[model samples]
Target chain A: MLSAGIDIGSRTIECVVIEDGAIREIRQAPTTFDPRGQIENVLAGVSFDRIMATGYGRNLFEVAYDAKTVTEIKAYGRGARHLFPEATTILDIGGQDSKCIILGPGGKVQRFEMNDRCAAGTGKFLEVMAEALNFSLEEFGPSALKAGKVLTINAMCTVFAESEVTSLISRGENREDIALGLHLAVVKRAAGMIRRLWPGGPIFFAGGVARNSCIQHLLEKDLQVPVIVPDNPQMVGALGAALLLEEGA
Target chain B: MFGLFGSATPNSNERYGMTIYDDHYLGGIEERVIRDTETARAAGAKVVGVYCAFTPKELIAAAGAIPVALCSGSDFPIPLAEQHLPRNLCALIKSSYGHAIGDSCPYFRATDLLIADATCDGKKKMFELLGRKRPLYLLQLPQTSATAESHAYWLGELRRIKVILEEETGTVITDDAIRKQIRLYNRLRTIVHEAFLLNTGPIPLLSGRELDTVTSVAGFELNLETRIAEITAALGEIKERDKDDDYIASVAGRPRILLTGCPTTNRKVLHLLEDCGGIVVAMESCGGLKTVGGLVPEQGDPLKNLAANYLSIPCACMTPNKARLDLLLAIIRDYRIDGVVELTWDGCHTYNVESFQVEECVQATGLPYLHVITDYSENDTGQLKTRIEAFLELLN
Candidate 1:
């Protein structure tokens, strides 16, 4: 049996196809203000026995296959359990938000902490910081590991943080050190969320931006846990959707 | 249909007083009320309490204190807030001066100490920001109370706040005292909640927005129980709209959205939302319960009752241990709400804290959320009209 999954996010979308528990095809796209056309394009050439949608915009569109949609959190948890059974805590950071999901011994999501109210500590936040430091998000996570001394980025507002970053820049601060400072500030925000949930782990980092070495390096250092990133972590939500289709199938 | 203000409407009855909602400006009503509220130095009302409707703040009365609604003092600015929070933080915080600490307004000289709580993140920081004053009491709340454990945790915190005030104010808070206050408060709350009830019930003399004024101002008076009793009776006499009036909505956001920076007087804004459909049967706002009055403290260690009432009502302000907006949303669910018109003020970071969370929650409730960014001033009709038309266009 063939199955298809669409993961609509606050800022991006992903679609995956699976046949009898084996992966077939997957495509990812930015969740724009107008993503329907792109969404249709991503789902192209993907004919399936069943179609399921999930995430913030899961219900926005109708697909050809029999419809079933779950929350992105639930899908992420289920997918994580299937991929990395030892992932006690699944920290999925998407475009507009980040969440800390605690899994029980049974691999079910027991307790979760999410910061969706503000865009202070997510991929978009990272993207803005990237622009401020004259680096790509691809360089954000690792750039921090090279820091000699860490500085604190004070502002939570993206605009304010940029200005702060600029002032520090004009002050002739070391670029790598400044990047480390920013990485710390954003990490502190996530750390606060994790501290609240108080999850036990081998924490799993799953999201497109999670691939960044700076976010990963700092997360592992500050958290004192092995922060594991899935191969193609961005597809975790959609992959979760696909796996759920298999389990029920 | 005629507005559910009063009986004998239109040109038919000249004596029919207008509902405050039938107004040219929100600040105009506030100005009128503030005008009624003589300055503390002039009023000579001994022992007043600054009321923020996060919880029952009547405890100050039990301590032989008077309750005052902590509105903006014309002369004061959020110096303390600016010290810690950004300059672009909301005006409510900027103007939260004097209320947290004494302000230039003479109304503050009467305040013995400020009582506050972290019902939300913003208010939590407000308490921290205001902590420089040292006399404030900040209460904390659980994020989710749906579970038995979380409920007990929050309720236990509420109980602890009662104890702390007993120690600080030296007001003996007995069970009888609290039970009595709770009964009176429960009555007031029920009545006030009923007024905003969307299920075709008798509209209380106030709406959620108006509750802020009634509750906050009425807390200061000595004869609160009597005043509330009289007001409750008056509210009963007011008319209830025949059918489900207009926009039945669920107002959601971070709890501490007090401090009215801008005054809104746009019925078209309300009407546009209504015409878009759904009478705004309920919402959470400072102009609502935070200032509006409710909860009659049972005549007792009046101080404890004051504190108790502050703990009960919901606030959009970020107060500790308070999801006042969340609680309000749960209460208003009986009205069968369809959408939410999140009327926001520009530069109001307080409400922005939970705006997105609120939108997501409303979507979970199977409703659309219309983010109507407006200032307290009701002059942005064209912008509001466009936004409302575009947003409402989605619901259709």
Candidate 2:
């Protein structure tokens, strides 16, 4: 039977459609304040035999869709295993939160550390940094790569990051390098999360920001490992939801 | 008030301007807050009666007790406590001479009875630390708004308060009495709510630094009705009066990130945030906001005011994380928050598992958030500043 997983995050809503146990399609959209409306909108073209929802807004959507809801930790664990089957630590970074999930060699979640209360290590921080730099996020990595020497990006808050970025810009620093500096700052933020969960490495990074080349290069450099992303990185959680539901069935 | 279970002595020690109790002991926290022989005297205070120095003595009147937070002698440094707690533990708990090897707060030393709330884990420990000194009237509160159980739990605690106060102090709490206190609190909350509302809300922001001075008054007796009146008046007078001056933050979990998890809120970190072009308008965890609701329980039953108060605030540990998130979210939304900083204390269970989940929720709003892990000691001030500046720079 076909199953689906819906992840309604704080700033994004994602859906994964699975057919015959192989992932079929995944879709994502900005999570609106009214997640119910956003969920309805994101799933307009999708049909499913069974549905499970997850994330911070999991319960809200469960009540709306009358669907089974699973924790993001469960969904992410399943999704990460599918994407990086041999990976031990699946670091899933979303818009507002980051999860450093530990997996046994069997790919089940052993322990996980979640940074949900702050935005420093997630996509939202990147967007804020991107806006501050006045460069499309597409420009972030390449520009950062060009920096001869990296200037320090102080201030972890998205609000203050913008001000600091503007100051850096006005200081006549190359915008690209500054963007790289911000990327490094986020990497540093992620590192703190990584250390706390103490997931021994060979880590796999996932999330929408995983598509960004700049972040990929920077992250790979930071961890000194070959970083990988799923074919459709955004739907990893949704895919896990469908997978988890199927397993239970 | 004099005949309520303990000895009452009206003799004031001239040097300290306190009613010295003859039986004051020096072995525990309770003995430090109050001593025997001075139960009715105003030298000692109940912890519950004072959430902050700025909370006002009217709260004491409403709660039917004197609000005396210990503020004497040295800043009691619990080597173990200081090892774990942020420098932000309420000034009263840290500043008093009470945490000595065997000494309790003289105010608690003198008092007949008292009340305290589990607003923070440290304060909860204070209940035990001081309880060893005296049986503290407990409020399992100052919790976050997420758990429905909190409301029920708090109302129950308040009910216990009503019964216990009635039995112990020989003064039963009536619904009318509670409603009367509620009205006063509501009025005060309204005023306080209004104070944060002035300047179109969340203006004239005080740093955690400046606000610490206000919280230092938490150690003062809540019966200083005059002080409450003075604060009310002073708040009204500031032209740049910012009703929304939320400076406290609860930074939870570990990783030695500066200024994260609940620090009992003090001037230093608040000063740090403000100095870094940031303001701690809200807490990412149960750190700063627990004191807001622990003042009175507001559940369906007025009798369990204490419990009700505890259950109403925002906490991260409860089942329904939404209510807790919403409470902090409302503060962020209301305070016009520019950014959020997460403090992860080194060895907390409930928060460490879900700290990132909390970080994700806040980040989803497109707000600026930073995560720091610390052992919550004051020793690593410089490294914390560098990280703070770096995090602030990220916002630019």
Candidate 3:
């Protein structure tokens, strides 16, 4: 049997096709205002017996593309567990929000917490800070690693934090120090959510922000626990959507 | 189709997409409120506007005045409120203040006296500001009710309110009048409690959203007898429909959720949970079953009865809210709730802090609990839906 899954995230859309419980093809693209159109080109020649959708725009896909909808939490849980079978907690930081999901024995979500209507702990926040600091997002992580001192960025609001960073620059604060402080502030926000759940199992980080080495390092240092990042963390939601087809079939 | 205020006609079902079933239980609820208020005013009855549920409604009713809840759940007046109050206060507070200053709430405009209970810090300060525009009475509520002296202090405060109501309305309130009002309110509470019991049945005859709308509307309806009769008839009709195959299939085996947190005026959060296959079996928020939880003794001194009931309503503002925890455990067991969802409105520092303690208490029962800190914004709808769906997935 063949099945296809699509994840319509805030900033991106990912689709995966699985045939006989094996991943056959993986494709991704920038999410457009019309989620269905964003995936139309990526899914040009792909067809499957069933199509499932997950992520921010999952609800839109059901009526627009004749697909089934699953929440990103369930999709991420299934996808993270598939890669790391022993993972008991999954921390997924997407473009606009961050979340922590506690998994049970069968990879079911026991409890979860998400950033509350704030962009401080999200990728968009980092992108804005990176632009203000005149550094590409790719250079944000590695540059922070070489900082001489970690300045404190107390303002959690992105706009306030940017002005604070600019003032810090004017106050003769080192650029590397400001970059590291920004990374620390973001991770601190994410960690606050994680500590709310205080999951006792292995922590596996997923989502677009998990690719940042600085965040992963800070999380491990703050949590005093080893953090695991799966290969292709951004595709976890789509992968989980595909796996749901096999679980029920 | 006359509005509760008796000035405007009720909107058509097509405009609200209201089904016949919705109309049966909750049709023209706001209209009924206005009509009830207008009828009471025409009869030379004084109208008292109350902000907190902890205020004894029977006391105001005893003074031959109609007690109406004045908290505004409307979003349109929030900007107006922000002009006067801080921009980052609770949405309900801002909305209420805006409605008062902007003259949007007909109920507030009709009120002869406004009673504000210092339930939370934001409200306590906001009421001081609102006093500039209206005749405001602030009732001091004791935060810790564990001591004998505290009970007496609360009783004394309620009596002072009773005196204030009597003075403001120019009516002498007899003890017999207070006792009669207590009995009437007790019957009303019974009616609401029975309606809540409908949710505990194997197949709930009413949805949580419908139950909330019905009961919360009852709080505003000065004519309790009519409200009770309508609710009783609606439940009877729903009980009959509960046997339908499709209705049974729709609700059966859904995740049973117990919502405990701040008042959810906008029911989109509840609807989102149910849409994701989670049936809300019970709620402990401000507008939920707590509205009916104040069951005072029918045969007692009016002051003591009112005092006991006021102190018994466990608000998150109270330190060491053990009563709330006990009540939550009882509701969870009685309703067979599978999970608990605690939502704290943004900038509601009291409930936001208490949510962690609630989480700890609920987790001790071995049931999964999810704490969602949010506000009345559509931006977080997808996120709230995802977290609730995942929590339900844990139960299944």
DockQ for every prediction shown:
0.02, 0.02, 0.70
Q: How many residue pairs clash (N, CA or C atoms closer than 3 angstroms) in each of the candidate models, in the order given? A: 77, 119, 5
Q: Would you estimate the TM-scores of all the predictions?
A: 0.49, 0.47, 0.93
Put the candidates in TM-score order, highest first.
3, 1, 2
User: How much lDDT does each candidate structure score?
Assistant: 0.58, 0.56, 0.80
Classified by CAPRI criteria, candidate 1 counts as incorrect
CAPRI-style grade of the A/B interface in model 3: medium
lDDT of 1 by residue, A65-113 (tens): 3377665666788778877988878888878667777776676655565
lDDT of 1 at A139: 71
Let me know the DockQ for model 1.
Answer: 0.02
How well does candidate 2 score on lDDT at residue B125?
68
Instruction: Tell me the tens digit of each residue's lDDT in model 2 across A1-249.
Output: 888988877677888888767877778888877777788888897878889987777767766778876667667778888777787777788777777777765665555666534577588888878777777767766777787887788888888888988888888988877887888888887777777666456777787777677777877787787777777777778888898888872
Q: How good is the docking of model 2, as DockQ?
A: 0.02
Q: What is the C-alpha RMSD of each candidate to the true structure, in Å?
A: 13.1, 21.0, 4.1
**Candidate 1 chain B, poorest ten consecutive residues by summed lDDT:** B249-258
Model 3 residue pairs with clashes: B4-B31, B4-B34, B4-B35, B5-B34, B5-B35
lDDT of 3 by residue, A29-119 (tens): 9886776678787688887788899988887888787788788888888889989999888899989878888887788777777776666
| Candidates in descending DockQ order | 3, 1, 2
Candidate 3 second chain TM: 0.91
